[model samples]
Target chain A: MTYCVGLLLNEGMVFLSDTRTNAGIDNISTYRKLFVFEEPGERIIVIQTAGSLSVTQTVIAKLREADEDPDASPYPSIMQAPTMLRMVEIVGQVLSDVTADISAKVDRMSQSATASMIIGGQRKGGSPRLFLVYPEGNFIEATEDTPYLQIGEHKYGKPILDRVVTPETSLEDARKAVLLSMDSTLRSNLSVGMPLDLLTVLTDTCQVQHQTRIEANDAAFQEMSHAWSKALRESFTSVR
Target chain B: MTYCVGLLLNEGMVFLSDTRTNAGIDNISTYRKLFVFEEPGERIIVIQTAGSLSVTQTVIAKLREADEDPDASPYPSIMQAPTMLRMVEIVGQVLSDVTADISAKVDRMSQSATASMIIGGQRKGGSPRLFLVYPEGNFIEATEDTPYLQIGEHKYGKPILDRVVTPETSLEDARKAVLLSMDSTLRSNLSVGMPLDLLTVLTDTCQVQHQTRIEANDAAFQEMSHAWSKALRESFTSVR
Candidate 1:
């Protein structure tokens, strides 16, 4: 299982994903679920995936393959897509195709190879856009009314986001919101673990402004988690 | 659908449940999920249920009928149970029997007639006890390490309880904790709604210490909900 959240704010977009993946309780391993595709001033696309890892890895591998193919004129790569919507379409199509293909092979076992993704980024001329792409190749874009999208282990962390997030929120505040959201999920669910992948894409920049990996014992994350817990306790106590 | 939670604290026990039951989004109605059976000065038992309303209603009705039967003996009513453990067993057995009986009649439709319950109380000489009874006549007790049990649409309200509840928590704080937990669930899930039922049992008292029903527009509940939302926003803003 994984926990990934993407926030679309006026200043930019914030993306966060936990790295833990497990076949079972004893087979846990860390795998980065955040992928970044950049072309400097041209475009910057970030994808955070959750679900059957095999399907996501295959979809991503195919996307990267198309980007490097010498005869890739007809193939729509995330790097060469003309618009953010087109890029999302390409990613969604690839995800759907990969899942269908893999699921066909595993059908006899009653297993699913489906995966969902949160894809957000910008092209030079367009505004920053965020979308939650479904495993079936369908997707929904974030609007002013709902500026955040999350997949996997989502319910435990949702109330906070539902109450605190807005499109007008600053990037700094947005980052904190997503991190705290992830913190709540990490505490309640054992399948989602760290180190976490965090990234910010500033509007119009078409480049990654800041990115970092928060390890299990990272001091900053520890402090933030501790602070949030203490604050929550205090808040409950003060609420009459 | 329903949302019910029970906490076992050293001071006593706290139980809270939402009253909404829905056949579909268009068909929603209020039904009390909390039932109290007390032989004041001897025992006090509370049952909070979630799942197939019909099955729970039947189970509760049967229990009441048995208690009222002039010839009732040998078959233990909750009020006649020798201990809190026996009381939980009696309730679990009744719930399982009722569900199985109803499910057999509806099996062809592929619909489930399962319901779960959180039962907690104290007998005259016993300490407070809390159990989460499953649909299959089995149950698990809340321990010092994890003093709360929740059923139906539980995740949204879990993080708060995971952080704030303990065996040593005061009954006042415990009541507040469960209310806020219910508030979180109410905000996130349409299936769990107002006219919440809240009750508490003090250790060795063998009677309900407090009980109330909070309506949709109840002033005190509204104030608490508003205060919580404001405090959460402030906490989020204060987190560096």
Candidate 2:
């Protein structure tokens, strides 16, 4: 239903998310799933979501309550969390709690909804970090050996990431990698559509360094997609 | 788990499948999921399977019994089937029956297993045909618009096939396409492993044109896989 990816690289962290959500084939709509929390020189936290809209929306709503009214919320705000790890824990806890609350209400009818997220950023004193948080509130961090995390329609785009991405990958290449990864996904699956949200957090900026929305018909994205197809066909022919 | 793909091309048909079968991660074994039944010069039929081992094995055994002992079979032998469509029907019927029988046995314990198959063939005087048979016995054919069908751990290998395969693609290219597709699946999923089975039936030839079992460390296969990875990484960099 969605495709979101994050890469923790030597240069910075790259995050991308597609905006399509659907209750069924005929009930598709666009919704921005990437949320950014920033304090320019203090910290930057990026959250990309996929799965149930209600679950994801509530997770964000709860996190924002902590952000906008820290004293009234039961948990510390992600923006004010002591570290990136702490911020991830709060987001995961919120997601886990929201999912449980909803599932409880719907369980009798055999309905279930849950969401997963990729949360990554940097605090002034720490190196950049990226994590993939599960619906159960557990999470795994990106390391030098595996510096990328993805949520939603992930398998279609995974081989490219697995084959090419590494800790030393430059932010520019990482952005391209995720786009190409998303490109493959878009072609194969109708459930994941565009426009896409993209943001880069330079290693120490603690805030988004560059951000843009890639529209469905964006000329540059289209050209890159066409070129990649051509290159792959050529490569396929040449491989033998 | 398995990864089996069948492509219907102008030149003929290309079928490829990985040999790995695992009851669990710790209990992996090599089992040929691709089976060929040819009455050379009369007909050539290939069945590539994915899903429950018990179900697939039973389906194949039943089909073989019909092929090898037509007098006792309730249905016409596939070897004597009037057309490629008839052959597909036989396979699908057997699969459906086997699945139902097995499921009924296990249903009491709340456990069930089913298998899906890709069957393609040519009968003398008829055109080459490819069909993806479901556990329910219903099937869909590969057409000019979508000339390839895949089963089991399919997503990782799908984008390439979507972009490169077509009715007009050469058999040579079709073979390469399926191998590379399998390569992507192999790199991304542990359940889909090496020692792949590849087979081709040239147009109008009522028998296998060529068949090979690619070993895990086969030199040429390894070289192509390496070159593909390099080409992909280069293509990613050069896309922009």
Clashing pairs in 1: none
Each candidate: fraction of true contacts kept? 0.89, 0.88
CA lDDT for candidate 2: 0.92
Relative to the real complex, the DockQ score for model 2 comes to 0.87
TM-scores for every candidate against the unseen true structure: 0.95, 0.98
lDDT of 1 at B236: 89
Residues B82-134, model 2: lDDT tens digits: 87787788888888889999999989999879999999988989998989999
Give the docking tier of candidate 1: high
- Local distance difference test scores for all models: 0.90, 0.92
Instruction: List candidate 1 segments past 4 Å from native.
Output: A70-75, B70-75
lDDT per residue as tens, model 1, A1-240? 899999999888999999999998999999999999999888889999999989999888888987888376345778888888888999888988889999999997987778999999998888889999999999999999999999989999899999989998998888888899999999999999999999998888989999999999999889989999999999999998
| Model 1, C-alpha of B204: deviation from truth (Å) | 0.5
User: What tens-digit string does per-residue lDDT give for candidate 2 at A7-104?
Assistant: 99999999999999999899999999999988898889899999999999999998989999988999789888887888899998999999999999
